[model samples]
Target: MRRTKPYFYRLLQLSIPAAMLVLAACSTTPEQTGLEPAQADEPETGLVTIVKPFPENSFHDLLVAEFAIRRQQYDLALQLYMKQAKQTGDLGVIATAARLSQFVNNEAAALQSTAHWLTLKPDAAEAHFIRATALARSRRPLEALQHMEAVIGSDQESNFATLAASALAQSEMDQQAFETAIRDLLERHPDNLNLKTGVALTLQYRNQEEEALRLIREVLTADPSNMHALLIETRVLQQLGRINEAIDRLRFAVDEYPYHKRLRLNLAQLLTRSDIFQAKAQYTVLHNQHPEDDAIRLALALVNREIGDYESAKELLRDLLARSDQRDNAHYFLGRIAEQEEAWDAAMDHYRQVSGGDQLIAALTRLAVLRSEQDGLPQARADLAAARLRFPDQDIQIYLIESDLLFEHRLYKEGFALLSGALKRHPDNTNVLYARSLFSERQKNVALMEQDLRQILSNDPDNATALNALGYSLAILTDRLNEAQTLVSKALKLRPDDPAIQDSYGWIAFRLGDLEVAENYLSRAFSQSKDHEIAAHLGEVLWRLGRREQAISVWQQGLNNKPSSTIIEETLQRLQVNLPDSE
Candidate 1:
C-alpha cells in the first residue's frame, strides 16, 4: 500500500535465485521433453553415475550437473556444476554454471562465470544461447540480442537454437531475422504445429495480428493435431468474431490431447464466454479428471462468477487458496474472487503475498481503481502516482487507468491529456492512443482525435480498439460515413463480438438512417453491462427513433447508474425530459 523509490528493486533480491532460472529457462526444451525413460529403463545412461574418467568425462558430468538442478537442491547443484565446468573447459558448461549461480541470487558470480565461459567457448553455439538467456532475464534486451546473434551465427540446428530464436523474436524485436529463420524452419516441418505456432506468435509481438492469424490457419490446415496451435487459433478466432469456429477448434484439441491441461483450460475459457452450460460441463469433466488441479478449481470458480453464483465462486477460490501450499498464483486469483465479493480490504491484503511483476501490477491497478471509486480523483491520482514511482520505467498502465477515472468524472479534457502524456512516454502504446481518440470524439475535437486514431492504425494496422474508436467517432460526429464503414468492418474482422466494437457498427447504422439496426446493436451492448458510453449512445438513438418515453427513461437510468455526466445533461435539456435523480 505504501510506495517507495522503484519497488522493482525487490526483483534484485529475486534475481539471486533467478540466475538459476536463467540457466533453466535457456536449457534445450527438446522435442522430447520430460523423461519417458530411454525405452523401458535401458540403463540410466550418462546420468546417475559418477564419472569414471572424472577429469575428461565432460558430457556425463554436464548431465549430472543439470540433474542436480532439476532436483531443486541449489547448493549441491552449484558444487556439482562447478566441478564439471572446471574439468572440461567447455564454455557451454561454464555459461550454464553461471546461470545456476543466478538461481541462488549470486548475480555477480553468474556474470563473472558466464564472462569466463564466453572467453573460453568463443565459438560455442550453446554458450551464446545460454548467455543470451541470462542477459534477457536480467532485463538487458540489447545485450541479449547481441548474444542471440552469436547463437544464431554459430549453428541453427541445435535444440537450444530454437528457443534462442523464439526468445529473440519476441523479446529483442529481431523480427526480420526471426521471421526468416522461423519461416524457413516451418517450411520443412510443415506438420509441426508447435513450430508454426511459435512463428505465428512472433507476428503477434510485431503487431501483425492479421499475418499471425494467417500463419495459424496455415498450420491448422496442414495438421489439425497441433493442439497448441489450435488453442492459440481459438483465442484469435474468439477475438475476431468467429466464436463458434474458435470453440470448435478447442473442442477438437480437447479430444486430441485429452491429458493436456492447457488445452482443457483454453476450452473452459472459451465456453465460459460463449456457452455457460458447456463451460460448466467442461469444468466438471476437467475437475473430475485432474481431481487436484487447482487451476481447474479456479476456472470453475470463474464460471460460477459469470453465471450469477458469486457466493459459490467466493467459497471455491477461498477453499482453493487455503489448500494451495506452494501455489502463489492461486492466491492472486483468490484476490480477484475476493474483489467480486466487494471485499475491497480483503482483496488488498490477499494481493500482498503474491509475487511477480505481472501479478503485482494487476493488484496495484485493481487497488487503484477501487481507491479512485471510493476516495475520489485526488486519492486515485496519488495511488497511480505511487505505482508510477514504484515502477518508474516499467510499462505501467497508469495513464490508461487515470484516463478512465477522469472520463467517469466528466473531466474529458484532463482524461485525454493523461493519454497524450502517456503517448509522449510510450509513443507506440496502442491502448492509450485508442483511449485518446475515443475521448477526443466525446469532447468534439474531430481533427486531433482522427489524427490520433490514424496514427495507431498506421503503426498497428490491425489495432481493433483504434479501428472501433475511429469508426464509431466518424459515425456519431462527422459525415465520413464511408470511411466509418471501412474502419468498423476492419475492426469487426479483428474483434466482432466485443460489445464496444458492436456499438461502433450500431452507431454507423444510426448514421445511415437505419434506426432498427442501431437499436439492435445498442441493445446488445447494454445487455453486456459494460460502460456508461453504451447507454448514452443507445438513448440518443432511441430519441431519434421517436421512442421518446423510452429514451427519457434510458438516459435517466444511465445517469442514475453513473451521475454527473455532460452527455446526460445535454440529452435531458435537449429533450426537455423530466426525471428524478438518484441519491
Candidate 2:
C-alpha cells in the first residue's frame, strides 16, 4: 500500500517548491550589456525612464511568503500562499493555504482553500482531514465527522478508530447528541474493537461509567492481553475509588504477562501508593532488567524512600543526579531526605539546586524553615525574600513563611506588620488573616484576634485551625470556659488525630476543672508530638492535681528537649516549682 502523507506533512510539502523558487531566483543573473562611450555631441537623452518596479513574480511572492512563515506572520503567509495556490492551481499549495489559514484561526479562508484543495485532488486524504479539522473548529461536528469518514474511507490504513475518537474528543456538540452520533457510527461497524473502544472512551467522557466499564470488559474478555482495555479498566476502577481492586487486577495482569514491561510498571506504580513493600520488589525487578533506565531507577529510589530504606534511596538518587535528565528531581528528593535527617546544610544545598518543577516551592519553603531553625529569623527572611524575587507567583506562600518565622521568634510587631501588608495586597486572603490572628493572640490584642478568626470562620465555617486557635486562646486568657470548650470540641471532632487540636481540647478541659479529662487528652497529644507547649500544659495539669513528681519529670524532659521554651519557663515560675540541681 502506498502510504499517504499526514495532513500537516502534506501542508509542509507545499513550502518545498516555494523554497526552490526562492533559491532559483536568488541564483538567476540578469543579462550583462556592454556599455559604449557616449560622444559628447550626441543629443543628451534626458528621458529618465522611471521604470515602475516590475510586479513581483510568483517566485518573489513565494520567497516573501516562506519568510513570513519563518517570522510567525501566519496571516500574511496564508494570504500569499492562497494567492499563489489560486494562480498555480497546485493541490499542495491549496492544502498549505488551508492549513495555515486554520492555524491563524481564519475559518472562512480555511474553508475556501480546503474547497480548492478538494477540487484539485478529491482523493487526497490530507485534504479531507484539513477540511474536517476546519469544520470541527467552526463547530460543525456532523460535517466534520463526514469529512473525517471520507478521509478514513479513502485510506485503508487511516486508523479510523483514532480519527473517530479524536473527533469525538474535540467535539462541542451536546453530550446525548454526540453519543447518539457515535452510537450510530458504531452500529455500522459493530465488530470493530477499536471503534468499540472509541465509543467506550466517549461514554466515559460523558460520565456514563457503567456503560464504559461494560464495553471495556467485553473487549478484555475477547482479548485478555489487550493493553488498552486493561489500562482503561484500571482507570475506571480508580475513578470509582476501588483502588485496591485496580491494584489486584494489575497484579493479576502482571502475573499473566510477566515480560510485559508496561504491565509491570503499572502494577509497580499502583502498588507504590498502597503496598510499598510490593512496590519496592516490583521496581527492584524492573531495575535489574533495565539498569540504564533513569525512570525505573527514580521509581526504585522513590519506593525505597517510602519504605524507609534511606541509604538505598540516597544512593539511587545520587546516581540519578550524576545524570542530567533527572537531576532536578534527584536534588528535590535528596533535599527531602536530608531534611528528614536534620542535615540542614546538605538539605539546603540540595534544595538550592532545584530550579524548577512542582517541587520548587516546597524546596524553597524547606530552605526557609531550615535557615530559621539554624540561623534565626533574619537569615530565614532574607532567603525567603530572595525566593520571592525568583518566584513572584508564590507571594502568598512566601508571606506565610516569613510570618511564621517571625511568629516563632516572638517578633510579634514584625509578624503583624508583615501580615498587615500582605492583607492589604490580598485583603481577603484566608491564610494571611489566619496568620495575623495568631500574631494578635501573642500580642494580647484579644479583640483583634477574635475579629480575624471570626472573619476566617465566616468564609470557611469549618476551619479547624481557627476553631482550635480561638478556643485555646479563650481557655487560657479569658473566662469564657464553656464557649472555649464548645469550639475546641468542634475542632477535635473535625480533626480527631491532629495533635494541636488535641492539645487545645486538653487545655480547655483543664480550664473547665476536669483533671482526668485534661490528663487523657494532654497525654495523647504529648505522646503524638512531644511538643514543648503541650508538655508545659500537661505538667501544669499534673501539678494542679498534686502529681508533683510526675509534673517535675515532664517539665525536665521538655526543658531537655527545648531549653528555652517560654511556656515551660513561665509554668515553672508561676507554680514556684524548681528542678533539683544536679552536681
Candidate 3:
C-alpha cells in the first residue's frame, strides 16, 4: 500500500440533508458570523448557540465527528452532532445536525430543526437558506422556492445570496418560477458575473440550453478567465455530449488556473464522462496536486478498479489509509474497489468498519450484490434489512438494487415481481419505467419490451439508451428493417457516433440482408466497444459475405471479452452456413 493513488474522490453527492449549505446556519455562532463574541456565545439566548465560549469544542469530540463524516459515517456523526445540538441549543450545531439528517432520508427531522432555527432568527439569511434546503430535500419545491427567495432578499449583497440562488435555481422544479426568480435577480444585478451565471443556469434548467450556452460564451468572450463561466460552458458541452471538446476546454482552463483546486476537480469530473484515456489523464493531474486529498485519491482508486488495475489501486488505497484524514473513507473506498475486483473477503473487511447511513447504505448494497453473486440470497436480504434499518428513507433504491441483484443471479421471477409491484405503485417513475423495459428485454418478450420502450420514449423523447435499446431490439427481433433504421437514426441524432447506436444501425442493416453495409457499421461499432453482441452481429455479416476466417477470429475475440454471451454460439453457427469463400 504505497498510498498515493492518483485518483480523485467522487464529487459530493450531497443529498439535501448532508449538504453544508443546508447546515451552514448552525455551523457557527452569530459571533462566528462576525457578531459580538459574548452575545453570540451566550448559552441562554432566544436563538440557539452551536459553539459555547468554552474550550471544549476544539477538543477531540468535534474532531471525531468530523472524522466520522469524512469517513462517510453519517449515522454516528449525526448521533454525535444531534446530541450536541439538543444540549447546546446552538444554531450551528443544529445546522450540522440537519446536514447529517439528510443522509438518513430524515427530511421531516431536518425541516423541523431548520424551521425552528428560522423562527428563532427570522432575518438570518443563512437560516432561511438552510430551511430552503430542508424543504427542497423534502420535495417541497414551492416552499423551498419561497425560502430561497427569502435568502436572496435577506442578504442582497453577500456571496451567500448567490450560492443560495444557485441551489434554488438548480433544484426548483417549476420552470416558470425558477426562471422568473433568476430573471428578477439578473435584472437587479445585470453586470454581476455570478448573477449572470445564475441566469444562464436557470435558462438551462428551463431547457433553453443553447441560449444558456450563448450567455456563457458572451461572458467568456469578455473574460476568458471567468472560472464560473468556464465551468458552466464545460457542463453545457457535456450535456450536449461533445465530451472531447468539454475535456479540451476544461483542460485549457485548468492550465490557466493551475492552483484552483475546484477547477482541476471539475475537469476531472468532466473526464469521467469521457473516454477512459481522457478520464485517466484529467484525474492524474488532480491526483498529483492533492496527493493527500482523500476524495481525489479515492477517485483514482475507482478508476484503477474500472481499468482492471485492482491490485495497484488496492495497494494505493491501503497506503493512503494511514495518511487519510478520514480512515473510514480510505477503508470504504478500498472495500468498494475490492468488491468490484471480486476480492470478496477483502471487501467485507472494509465494509465491517462502516456503520452510519452513508457507509451502511453503501455496504448493504455491495454486500447484497456480493452475497447474491455467491449464492447467498438470504444473506443479501438480511444485509438490505440492515440498510433499511440504518437509512429508512431509501425504500426505492434499496428495493430496486435488491431486485437487480436477484435478477443478475438468475432469479428472474423474484426480480420481475419486485419491479412489477413497484411499477404498480409508482408507475410514473422514469427509472422504474426504464428498469421494467430492461426486464422485458432480458426475457426476450419482444412485444412487451417494445411496448414499455415506446412508453418510455413517449415520456422521454431524448432517452438515448432507450432509443438504442428499442432500435437494437427491433433489429434483432423482427424483420422491420426500415423502422429499425429510423429508430436508430433518431438515437444517433440524439447521441451522435455513440457506439451503441452504431451497433444498432449495423444490426438493422444485417437484418435487412445488406451484408456490405452491415459489415461497415458493425466494424465501426466493434472498434468503439468490445461488446459480445455487437461482435456477433458483425462476425455473422462477415461470414455471410464469404469472410469465414475473419468471422471465426472475431467470434473468438468477442468470446474472450464476454464469455457469457449466447450470441457467441450463434455466431459460430455462421461458419456452418453454405457461404462461398472470399475470392
Candidate with the greatest lDDT versus the true structure? 2
**How would you encode candidate 2's per-residue C-alpha lDDT over 30-114 as one tens digit per residue?**
1110000111122222221222222356567766776776677767887887897787664445655765776676878878987
Candidate 1 deviant stretches above 4 angstroms: 1-292, 297-342, 351-362, 391-394, 461-464, 474-583
Task: Give lDDT for model 1.
Answer: 0.64
TM-scores vs. true structure, each candidate? 0.49, 0.57, 0.51
Q: What residue runs in model 3 are displaced by over 4 Å at the alpha carbon?
A: 1-328, 337-343, 352-365, 373-375, 385-392, 478-486, 577-583
Candidate 1 lDDT over 1-583, as tens digits, reads 0000111111111111233333332322111112211112221122221223333344454445555555666666667667766665544445546656655755455566667766765665554555555565564444554455564434332222234334543434455565566666667566555555766766655556677799888987887676656666776676677889878877877787787878887788777777897898889788888978776877787778778787877777777666645245556666777787778777766765554444666666676677776677698788777667766764436666667678667788887777777788888666666677767777899998889879888998897777777787777678999899898888878976778787778878877888999899888877775355667778889988888778767777677677775667776677776666444
The total number of steric clashes, by the backbone 3 Å criterion, in model 1 comes to: 8
Task: Answer with 1 or 3, whichever has the higher TM-score.
Answer: 3
Which has the better lDDT: candidate 2, or candidate 3? 2
The clash count of every prediction, one per candidate, is 8, 0, 16
The TM-score-based order of candidates, best leading, equals: 2, 3, 1
Query: Which wins on TM-score, candidate 1 or candidate 2?
Result: 2
Off by over 4 Å in 2: 1-89, 96-192, 205-207, 221-226, 241-262, 284-294, 322-325, 406-413, 424-583
**Cα shift from native, residue 559, model 3 (Å):** 2.1
Candidate 2 global CA lDDT score: 0.74
Worst 10 residues of 1 by lDDT: 1-10
* Per-model lDDT: 0.64, 0.74, 0.65
lDDT of 3 by residue, 1-583 (tens): 0000000122112222333333333346532322111112322223333433423542344456656766877677767766666666666656556645644656676676667666667776665655665666654544565565565544333232243344444434464665676677667656665556667865665567788898878778887777877887877877787778877887787777887888888877766765655667767777888887777877777777678787867776787677636566667777887766678988876876665535555666676767766757887777776665666676567766776676567676666677787678677666666666666666777887788778878898887777777877776667766887888888888877777788788778777777788788889888888778777888888878888778777777777798776667755664564224323
